[model samples]
Target chain A: MKINLKVWRQKNNKAKGELKDYKVDHVSPDMSFLEMFDVLNEDLITKGDDPIAFDHDCREGICGSCSMHINGRPHGPLAGVTTCQLHMRSFKDGDTIVVEPWRAGAFPVNKDLSVDRSAFDRIIAAGGFISVNTGNAQDANNLPIGKEAADEAFMSAACIGCGACVAACKNASAMLFVSAKVSQLSLLPQGQPEAKMRVMAMVNQMDAEGFGSCTNTGACSAECPKGIDLSNIARMNREFFSANLTGK
Target chain B: MNWISTFLKSSIGKKLLMGLTGLFLCTFLIVHLSGNLQLLKHDGGLAFNTYAVFMTTNPLIKFVSYGLYAIILFHAFWGLYLVMENKKARPVQYASYNGNANSNWSSRWMGVLGTIILAFLILHMWNFWAQYKFGTTPYTQYERNLATGKVTFSPFTGEIAGKMEKFVDTERNVEITQVKDLYAIVADGFKAWWLVIIYVISMAALSFHLVHGFSSAFQTLGVNHKKYNALIKNIGVWLFGIIIPILFAIMPIYFLLLN
Candidate 1:
C-alpha cells in the first residue's frame, strides 16, 4: 500500500516540535506496523536523513515500547493491541496517516514518536513495590491465598506500566495505571506490610508528576493494550481513600 | 461566592456542584419544553401565549429563572476554563493512546460541544426570552383576533416574528401567538416541515453536547471509587444522551404531529 505520514519530530524535551510529512510505497500487507516503520527508517538512513525515531525494544507487544499515536489514536486505530503488533493491512491502499507524539503534559516527547515516560517509572518507584527483608525462600503453602484473590491480584499485576491509559484519558490522569499497581499488590498477603503506604506514596507521586485527575472518561481502558479493566481504578480509589483515613 | 468556591475545592464538592447544577438544568429543559408544547394543544393561540406569559410573569419562577441564567453561564465558563488549563497541565500523552478509548466521546470534545450548545442557547433566548422581556407580548386574549368575520392574517414580517416558532416544544400544545398574520406564522413557520426539521437538528446537537457533559461533570466532581464510578458514568450517558435528547426531540415531533 502507498502511504503518507505526518509525524511529530523534536530534538529533546525542551525543543518545539511540528508535524513533518513523508511518503512510503510498496508496503507489504504482512508487514507488522513496526516493520513497515523499519522500512521507512532504512530509507531515511540510506538517504543521509535522520531516521524517524520511536521507542521499540521488543517487536512483540508486551514491552509497550512502540509509543506512537497514529491518526490521533494510540497504537493506531486497532483495539486491545500494541503498535508493534499492528499490521499494515489495517490501513487503506493510499491512506494519509497522521502520526503524533503521545500528548499529556507529563509525557514529554523525547524525539519523533518516542516520549519520556520516566514519569511513569517515577510513579512506580514511588510506591509500586512491597518492601520485604532478606530471608530463606519461604514455603509457597505458608500463605493461605484464596482463588478469587489470587486471580484478581494476577490481573492487576498484568499491567505493563505503559502510559496508554494516560494518553487516552481526556484529563491525562494516571489513576488507572497507579490504581492497577496498587490493587495488584494490596490483594495479596505478601503486599500487606506496605499496602497502605504504597497507595499513598504512588497516588501522591502521580499527582506530583502533574498528571490531571481522572475524569472517568474511560478512555484509559479503551486504549489499554492489555485490556486492563477500569475496575482496577475503582479498587484503587477504595484503597487510596482507606489509606488516607486509616493511616494504617 | 462561597458556593463557587465550594464547587472548586474538594472532589466531593465539585461532584456535588456538577450533579446539582446538571440536574437543575435538566429540570429547566423539561419545563421549557413543556411550555413550548402548548403550540400543539387544543387552546390554539391562547394556550401557547398563556403558557409563555405564566413562565415570564410568575414571580417565584421569575426569581428561579435568574438562577437558571446563572447556571448556564457558570457551567459554560467553568467547563471551558478547566479544559483549557487541563490542556496545558498535561502537554504530551503516552505514545499509543489506546484502542478502547471508552464510551464517552462527547466528554473529550466538551469544549467544542459547549460552544455549539452556547450558540443554540443564544438562539434559544432570542426566540422566547428576549420577546418576553423587551418585545411586545399579548396583554389580553382579545388583542389576538380576526380583523373581520372574513378572517384576517398578519403578513409574516421577518425573522423577528418567526422567532418563537423557529424551535418549539413538542410535548404539549403551545399557543402560537398572533403575528403580522398569526395563522400564517404558526401554520407556515412551525407547521411547515422544513423549519421543524431545522429545530430537530439543533436539538440533536444539544443532545450530543450533553452526552459527554453529563458524565464528565460527575467525574470532575469526584464520583470516584470502584463501586460507584460505573454507576455515575452510566447515569451520565443515559440522562444526557438518552433522556435529554428524547425530551428535546419530543417537542418537534409533537408539533409536526399537529394539524
Candidate 2:
C-alpha cells in the first residue's frame, strides 16, 4: 500500500513548523503507524534528507510515549490505542494522513512531531503521589481495599501521562490528565493521608502551566488512548471543592 | 476572604463560577419562559400585561430581577474571558482540526452560540424590557362585568398614567382596569417576519447552548455521578435544550401565524 503523509517538521522548539508532504510506497497494511514513519525516515535518510522525528518508546500502548495527532485525533481514528499501536490498515491505499504534534502552550513542539511534555512532569512533581517512606514491598492483602474502590483506582491508574487529553481538548485543558492522576491516588487507602493537599497542589501546578480550563466537553476522554473517563475530572472537582471547603 | 479570592482565581474556581452562573441563568430561563408563556393566553394581553406589571413592580421580584441582570452580565463576560484564555492556551491551532470526531459541535462552538444568544438578548430586551420601561408601550383599558366575570379590552389613548389604574363602577357592576400593555408590544413585535426569524434562530442557538451547558455545569460542579448522570443529561438535553427553546420559539411563531 502507498500512503501519503503530511508530516509536521521543525528544526527545534524555537523554530517555526509546517506540514511537509512525503509519500511512502510498498507499505504493508500490518505495519504500525510509527513503523511506517520509520520506513519514510529510512527513505529520507537514504536520500540524504533530514528524517522526521517523533517520540515513541515501548511500541506497545502502555508507555504513552508515542504522541502524534493523526488526522486531528490523538491516536488516529481508532480509540483506546496509542499511535504505535495504530496500524496502516486503518487507512486505505493512497490515503493522505495528516500527522502533527500536540499543539498546546504547555507542550511546546521540540522537533517535527515531538513535543516537550515536561509540563506534565512539573504538574506531577507538584503533588501527584503519596509521600510514604518505602522500605520494602508490602503484602497485597495487607491493605484492605474494597473491590469497587480498587477497580476504580486501577482504572484511574491506567493513565500513562500521555498528553493526548491535552492534544484532544479544544481548550487544551489538562483536567482529564490531572484528574486521572488525582483519582489514582485519592481512591486508595494508601493515598488517603495527603489526598487534599495532593489535589490542591496538582491543580495549582496545572493552572500555572498555562493549560486551559476544562469545559466538560468530554473530548479528552473521547480521544483518550487509555479511555480515561471524564468522571475522573468530576471526582477531582469534588476533591478540590471538599478540600477547600474543609480548609485543611 | 483571602481564601475566597484565591479559590476564585484558580482555574477550577473560575470553572466553578461559570457553573454557578450558568445554572443560575438556567433557573432564570425557566422562570422567564414560564412568565412569557402568559403571552399565549387567550385573555387579549390582560394576563400577560398584569404579570409583567407584577414582575417589574413587585419589590422582591424587582430585587431578584436586578440580581438576574447582574448574573447575566457576569456570566457572559466571564464566559468570554474564559474563552479568550482558552484560545490563548492554544496559540497555534491544528491545521486540520476535526473536533466533531470527539466532541459535539455544540460543545466546541459554545462561545459562538453564546455570542449569538447575547446579541439576541440585546435585541429582545430592546424590543420588550426597554420599550416597556421607557419607550412608548401603549396601554389598554380592561372592563370586566362583576356578575358575568366576562372581560373586554380596548386600546387606551388617554393621558399618560402609572403602570396600572383600577376603579369599580357600582351602577354598571363593572370593574375597569387600565394597565401598560407589554403583551401588546410583544405580540406586535413578533408580527415582523424578520424579527420572528431572528427569534427562531436565536432560540435554536439557545437550544444548542443549553444542551451542552446544562450537563456541563453539573460536571464542573462535581455532580457527575453514575446514579444522577442520566437524569442530569436528560434534563440538559430535553428540558433546557429541546423543550424550553422550542416552547420559547413557539411563542413568536404563534403570534406571527395565529395571533
**The best candidate in terms of DockQ:** 2
lDDT tens string, model 1, B1-259?
5534532443323334555586678778768767666665544455565456566668898899999999988877766666775676566543334333465565566578777777778865675566556655433221222332122223333444332442222443322243322322344345657656766777777787766666555444334556776786576567667776777666656667764
Query: Residue-wise lDDT of candidate 2 within B180-253, one digit each (tens)?
Result: 99988888888899999999999999999999999999999998888999999999999999999999999999
Each candidate: how many clashes?
38, 0
Point out where model 1 deviates above 4 Å.
Answer: A1-7, A16-31, A35-51, A88-98, A130-146, A169-171, A185-204, A212-217, A234-248, B1-20, B27-40, B44-67, B89-105, B133-136, B141-199, B215-259
Q: Each model's C-alpha lDDT?
A: 0.70, 0.93
Candidate 2 per-residue lDDT over residues A18-45, each given as its tens digit: 9999999999999999999999999999
Measured over the true interface residues after superposition, the C-alpha RMSD of each candidate is 5.2, 0.6
A30-111, model 1: which lDDT tens digit per residue?
8988888899999999999999899898788888788777876778788888888889999998898888877878887888
Candidate 2 Cα outliers beyond 4 Å, as residue runs: none
Using Cα atoms with residue i matched to residue i, what is each candidate's TM-score against the true structure?
0.69, 0.98
- Which ten-residue region of model 1 chain A has the weakest summed lDDT? A239-248
Query: Distance from true position, residue A204, model 2, in Å?
Result: 0.6
Q: Who wins the lDDT comparison?
A: 2
